[model samples]
Target: MSNYSRFSRRRFLTTAAASGIGAVFLKGCLGNPPEPVGTAVTEQVEAAEISPEMMPETTKVVLGYIPIVEAAPLIVAKEKGFFAKYGMTDVEISKQANWASARDNVTIGSEGGGIDGGQWQMPMPHLISEGIITNGNKVPMYLLAQLITQGNGIAIAGKNQGKGLGLDISNAAEFVKNYAKTEGRKFKAAHTFPNVNQDFWIRYWFAAGGVDPDKDIDLLAVPPPETVQGMRNGTMDAFSTGDPWPYRIIAEDIGFMAALTAEIWKFHPEEYLAIRADWVDKNPKATKALLKGLMEAQQWIDGVNNTEAVVSIVAGRNYFNVPEDILVPPYKGDYKMGDGKAEIKDKMMGPLYWKDGIGNVSYPYKSHDLWFLTESMRWGFHKDAISDIDTAKQIIDRVNREDLWKEAATEAGFTADIPASTSRGVEKFFDGKTFDPQNPEAYLNSLEIKNV
Candidate 1:
């Protein structure tokens, strides 16, 4: 084990002893907390045990997710015997290096053999839609379930940090423009993928600030866990990632959170439980079973007490590999990135169980996909890629298996009355102007920067 891990374990035990609380990972430099005297079972453990027969009888299913708190439901389901209760034994969960690795694993494992499903950053399927990555290799992917919704925050380090640095201002939008002009330096922020929620959020936030992210910011693809290290290493000035990292940074007093993704747009969607097309084709029944398990886990995690258990479980070394204190939500109904400075909240980020199944695995809303595509194009990831809006929509439609999700959700007891058609809801950012998802042409046209 690395020095960090050793230190963390020692710290974890000490904290537990004093508070009688379960262990929580507190990465990004927490010293230590008083030890609790006794071990305590999280509320999740106490939830009435589920029987193995309650779930479908499926063989082993290999699952992949990045090491982040958003993937907690999967862990909870597995650890708490939800998977076993549902008749799924030999369920394997592995942490991939990054989003690209996770997506590739889904494609290859689904095609070659038994890689059941993989969790993906919310915008990845959309990227395949815009023909942004690996052309023709973009296999049709399906959304079995929506995992966690909003879970990211924008973190800014001190001025002593390297490139992409911006001043702290209450009005995040104005801060970007003035920082760009006065600093005469391109601001940098790390995100796990160029086509994910954080990617879209950074671009949208900048746009709202009157500074075009496409023109002003240099966004890089860095995995979530590595972001703070990047900031500490002076390779990045700020970064946007979900959970723990920002809170971890603040707990250690390394930096301040500039904004939360929910601030950019309340009810913003983030990650999903995505599977490659072929996998869905081969194991359709298994897919439904997996969705049921996930839905149950989602509902469990949403309970206030269960949320506390989630923080403890995901913080373990086997999962997120961070100290538990770092994973705790800093505020009630909100998240603080740095020292409780900035907070954002929305209904979407909350737990979403089967609203009676039909609404379970809904298709990716056009607006949600568009924002990421626009960001990829805006930030230069889509160079020479398909620029036509119609083509983008087709790509999105092919991969987003909302229909499949509906079936699974219905089976899981989720509501089936979700609007059959996608909505072109206006994209509201902190700056106030709305980007209409339905009117992509006009939205793109209105932008001051080059679309291509």
Candidate 2:
């Protein structure tokens, strides 16, 4: 094991015990599974009590999160008293082992010792609603709000540094295509989960460069730690994952970032905050209360002044369990791309919660949901579930609940930030490909290397 990994594990065990945060073993993951940890809230802030009519049906909730930047808002809401301020005093932020564990846990819901809902990748709510990734048992869900934007990217192994593995790999596409012939194995790559945000990012990057992702490379889902170890041992060549991991690669000299999702599509939609529709329906007031808390946390984290505090709170052993320095660069938008690529130093390039270059990041824009489904179609993922554009639109309409986000924002006195439209309009990617929500079919047809 790498020294960093060993140190992190020791720190996790020591701090988790000292802090009195209950840590449970998580089964079924690569390597030894780290004990599942939850929020250890400190210093509760006093706020005005909710009116009798506005009081939530329930004050408690269990939300799942992976220890990544996308999960900052959820963790912050719990740690900084934002949830309690909004009348959600019993909120629990549970750490998930991996995306698959999250999926399985959510399948059983909170009553069954699982999460009610929490941070999620694009289209997962839709897929779970339609029973695509849920073992064919539909669990209706609502896409409440987007958790974050940017903070994700593609990483290339250090061994492949100078072979045209940057953002635009068109110049060395042949090098990637001929890996099997020369190296005696297919160029291996991985994402956190299949048919999700990370998977889509890598697929788009590969297809844009005239390299067929399916034919030219071996792409599969692997946990982030294993992915990093694979890169170190020269077993994995590339990875598409969220913040901290990508930065860890560069800090440990294991790999260099090929591109940020921010560069892939500036201020692009990343992960989301979604919940079971049954949960939302049963406790509408509580649902709004959760959104209000998340809104406060999101707005708080966006302030440049709070970067250090944000890093400190979320990097605790009970939370992300990563080194503070590893998170500092990405949170400050100070990425060192290595491999002769220019370094990026724009604050907006980091994870943004409430707003970004275009508009409100907290709003669950229906247009962004359309793009995920359209991209899924491009790769022919879950074709039986999302057979066509019309089917995808129906799913989006059912899953995305922008109206609830607006209600929560307005109630929280954030009326000014609510977007006027559900769509963010046409989005342009790094490779010059544009996805127009109005013409998703045209967008799909425009792709040169797709199963569809």
Candidate 3:
């Protein structure tokens, strides 16, 4: 049964009464002032009773989401009452139409009756901070928390599954590179966004194999949900994106799993919980409360035992809307790559919400942001992507909310999991490349292929 099953029959009746499902059963008119029916009773809360520390400075918080499982922490918190527990009584987890829309909406904010914050791409906060995404009319955004890391899967053509391939993508890229040069046809790979982490994974995959992602093959920015069909229709030779899509490729035998992104760069921080900086500054307590609830929801999701229920919740109409079967395999650590190579999911692929979860992920890790900034530069995604490591750190620090994460985590008693240092310390990519946060310039110079 779902968490909603635990609600009492009386509570259900009251909710149903308001919703017009049970007008016959309701003793009074739907609009009539009601008494408390149960815990939380109706949506309204008593402002006098709410301690200032416990309440958001403003009760109305509109959080936008993309309906992917990367949104688990946010969705789970709202569904499980973590938001309410933190005294953010009026919360809206609005479904987003696309990444561009989510960014634009959150950038504008509830002042325009738009979203105040949301599950935005990781690079966005930095971009926003630099006034890149917003241009001169910048709306400063902050990374409140990271959502999920390494929940993405890479799928290659079934024909090329084991054709000169080891576990790494080097072999595939080599084949594609040679094919592209001789045939003048570049293999196309679809990702959700350019300059976003998904595109980073795609570029990194090809480049690891000595194929220039910028020149050798076409990288198309297709929506995540459309990737499977894009592959099926031969629009792309391979596709990479968040879970369920790659799982769809695997189950349907259309393509083979190349590597989970985490395999490429273990627990590469992806999606984030971000909000307008003004919102954070205005509602410090509410911000902490948001983190507190999400932290708890993440803990709940970290348990593999909860995978099915987690899938059920996320796969419903309001979320991923993908079938539960498609969602189950990846969540349960099973992978049947279309190439007849089946491997259990790598827990390190995190499939992770917490930095301590399933071998983990990170937040406002200045080094992590440094890497993202470098990747964006590599692709020429940001016209003026910062090349200076020191300046990058300053920019990241300006937008990052590690202090907020610390306050919430410590108050929630998760201090034990906090790392002694903010940096995950020089990350190693699957291509055998190391990124030293101290020397981002050297790291960028080491790359053999880059648009920049």
Best by lDDT: 2
Residues forming the 10-long window of minimal summed lDDT in candidate 3: 19-28
Query: Could you tally the backbone clashes for each prediction?
Result: 30, 0, 0
Model 1, which residues run further than 4 Å from truth? 1-58, 110-116, 126-132, 160-185, 224-226, 233-235, 330-334, 337-367, 374-385, 416-424
Tens-digit per-residue lDDT, 37-104, candidate 2: 55555544455356666677887787888889999999887777777676676777777777877777
lDDT of 3 by residue, 1-452 (tens): 43332323343233322311111111222132111111122232111123434555664577877656788888776665556665555566766666766666666677765678888776877776676766555788888788888778678766555664435655466678776675457787887766777778877877877778778777888765576665666656778777877777777877778777767877678888889999889989888878887887788788768887777767765556678998877766666665656676665554777754323353557667778887877767766547555666777888888888888778767887776677878788777789998777778899988877
The residue-by-residue lDDT of candidate 1 on 1-452, one tens digit each, is 44422223333233222212242322212122111111232332222222333333444577776667668777777666554443444456665656665555554553353244667776676554333554556656666556765567778765533333232233454555555586566667777776567776666655655666655667778865577776766556677777766677767666777766655665556677777666668766667667666767777776656656777767776677677666655323455544434454533443233231123323345556666665555545655554666666666676667666566556656654445666536766555556677776676666665445
lDDT for predicted candidate 2 compared with the true structure:
0.85
Q: Which window of 10 residues has the lowest lDDT sum in candidate 2?
A: 4-13
Ranking by TM-score: 2, 3, 1
* Stretches > 4 Å off in candidate 3: 1-54, 159-162, 165-167, 180-184, 355-362
Ranking by lDDT: 2, 3, 1
Task: List the candidates' TM-scores in order.
Answer: 0.75, 0.93, 0.84
Better of 2 and 3 by lDDT: 2
Which candidate comes out best when scored by TM-score? 2
Error of 2 at 29 (Å): 9.8
Question: TM-score of predicted model 3?
Answer: 0.84
C-alpha lDDT score of every prediction, in listed order: 0.57, 0.85, 0.69
